[model samples]
Target: EAAVTQSPRNKVAVTGGKVTLSCNQTNNHNNMYWYRQDTGHGLRLIHYSYGAGSTEKGDIPDGYKASRPSQENFSLILELATPSQTSVYFCASGDTGGANSDYTFGSGTRLLVI
Candidate 1:
């Protein structure tokens, strides 16, 4: 079965720090994505990848970076974490590029910065 898994289901960080969110995708899905959900912003895409060795920045990539090492792995990194960056992050895998990308998501990682 194709599935996405994110680690450190919850996190807490100081004002200026670094946070690394890890994701693993199984089931040979060609497209994977990272999204953050916040109250006012709704849900915004942060990063995505087509396949192994390919990572692309999404709409709001200012404070984020992504890495795709293999067909089954992707990671989102916040080089300098801030309080405003605190939110629930999700990892998803799917068959993409069509009209609608059928995505299956991981539980989520909730991050809180102080």
Candidate 2:
């Protein structure tokens, strides 16, 4: 079966350091998304891409960057990690056909910046 996988399920980074979270999908979905879940706030989109070589800024892309070098891979980068960035990040792959289209999500990556 197809799946979405994320690396380094958990990570601890120092403030001002750089962190890169990666995602890989076997579902062949054309759309990939990156989101972060915080305590008070719900899941917020950080960045996304429609396909290879196309990355778009999402609702909350201030402190994050995204790269889609290939159709099956996407990466989220934190150039300057900070405490406020500590959260559970999720990666998802989906189709753009319709609203009912299925979306496969990775387990999630828990990041802590101290």
Query: Number of the top candidate by TM-score?
Result: 2
Candidate 1 has an lDDT of 0.91
* Tens-digit lDDT track of model 2 for 55-106: 9999999989999999999999999999999999999999996884667899
The count of residue-pair clashes in candidate 1 stands at 0
- The lDDT leader among the candidates is 2
lDDT of 1 by residue, 1-114 (tens): 657889989999887799999999886888889999998887799999999999898889899999999999989999899999989999999886686678989989999999
Clashes found in each candidate (C-alpha, N, C closer than 3 A): 0, 0
Deviation from native of the Cα of residue 28 in model 2, angstroms: 0.2
Q: What's model 2's TM-score?
A: 0.96
lDDT against the true structure, per candidate, is 0.91, 0.95
RMSD in Å for all candidates:
1.3, 1.0
lDDT for model 2 comes to: 0.95
